[model samples]
Target: MGKSLLVLENLSPGRNLDAYMQSVSAIPVLSVEEERELTERLHYQEDLDAARRLVMSHLRFVVHVAKSYSGYGLPLGDLIQEGNVGLMKAVKRFDPTVGVRLVSFAVHWIKAEMHEFILRNWRIVKVATTKAQRKMFFNLRSMKKGLGWMNNDEVEAIAADLGVDAKVVRQMEGRMAASDTAFDAPVSDDDDSAYQAPANYLEDHSADPAHQVEHQNWEEDSQRRLMQAMGELDERSQDILAQRWLSEDKATLHELAAKYQVSAERIRQLEKNAMKKIRVTMEA
Candidate 1:
């Protein structure tokens, strides 16, 4: 299991959030030597405590990155929690031998987690699932800062910057601009706008008399075959089949066992035999 994430639901954002920010910021930045030493200990010795200290010291940086995602309307604490998970993963994989600072290497991982969290919760359904779409999704959100729609030059410029075709950029923008609405209307007394919803236009083609009769005939034929197959079993087997297979919320082996004063194993065996006999009879 992954690390359990912290939730923002319990945070009031009153005095407690202020205190948390102050406390985390006050944690002295690890010196170059100190960071290397801790990272090495965790890397070679597998010292979990060393890893924990490294994560804690970097919590403030996560806060700084999470602040940029505030406009997403998600809980700040949740964003920070996702960022923390990314930080831990970076710590576990970091190599001080690579000749790069830990924070510099960790920035990509931190934003990746935060970006996923925002995209998932930003809409009722996901807008982007592939790598190409993910690039377009974020680029379009940034481009939407000013307007009803983008001008031609603006779209081309964004396409060039993101290395996608201008036509693809326009399509992505159009998708992002659309909004979702309920399929059905609310209970309303006003006749003027009541029929404006899609529910009024949705057709139930199966309500036709010919289709209804066909469906009824199919059900009757299936039921007749089921009864004929069940009759191939003995009386006790039929009762067991009815209770275990045909009942709504069919009986469990334990329930059948209690009813017949037998072990659950015996009930299961009988049920299995009854089913096999029915299947074989139906096949014949």
Candidate 2:
């Protein structure tokens, strides 16, 4: 089967999309008897020739599914390519005994591959992560009637139909409406437009010298106060506090209790008292 699949690799949709479409369309569609026979040969006998015939016959269906996703701004060739992958997977897992045509079973796999491709390449940041959002992302586009934003009533209607909150519908609409922008503006001869890029005006406050110095001083002061407060406690209390909080591998309450030869509750009490005293000292 591996060698047979490789033979059909050249038939894949490529840069010459029109030619690829024509070629796949030219291949004759299989009859019910022919399809069943090929599927059985591939399924039970592991016949590579039967597998190749099955995949080749299904190429036209893959193209048809990929065309519906043309609005996503992805290359049609790429969409067809992804759909082809799904078709191949469907072929590999297909059971002729299921009493369903291969085309009916393959539709889900075909659309699934194309969906993943769109989500990955649609934007610089992902627009949909959850199951509901993914469903909304595809359906909402078709549900929209015009170029303008959806009105409140339209939003509510679509939300109810899709079984999502109205807010979620609006959120996905916003994501789809947005377009990618370059952080740095393209090089232009016009001076006025050059300063409009995000890189020109957005400030990085972390790099400011005053902020850096203030953050460093605050951290040092906090550390100094913590040390002073801890020093004021008894030696045993200090050891417990250090083991519980300061050590790289901090001791658990039960472990500390075993070492101190006390119950776990006693260790919790000591830890609580130590934290309270530290907080009071730091605040003072």
Best candidate, lDDT? 2
Q: Put down candidate 2 lDDT per residue, 1-284, tens digits, no spaces.
A: 34434444555566677767877777788899999999999999999889878888999899998999999899999999899899989998899999999999999999999999999999998999887789899999889999899999999999899887999999999999998878898876378887888888999999999999999999999999999999988888899999988899999989989998999999889889988998999999
Off by over 4 Å in 2: 1-12, 262-269, 280-284
lDDT of 1: 0.81
| Model 2, position 9: C-alpha lDDT score | 59
Each prediction's TM-score against the native? 0.65, 0.88
**Alpha carbon deviation, residue 90, candidate 1 (Å):** 0.9
TM-score of 2: 0.88
Residue 218 in candidate 2 has what lDDT? 99
lDDT of 2: 0.89
> What local lDDT score does residue 118 receive in model 2, on the 0 to 100 scale?
96
* TM-score of predicted structure 1: 0.65
Q: Which ten residues in a row have the lowest lDDT in candidate 1?
A: 1-10
RMSD to native for every prediction? 11.2, 3.2
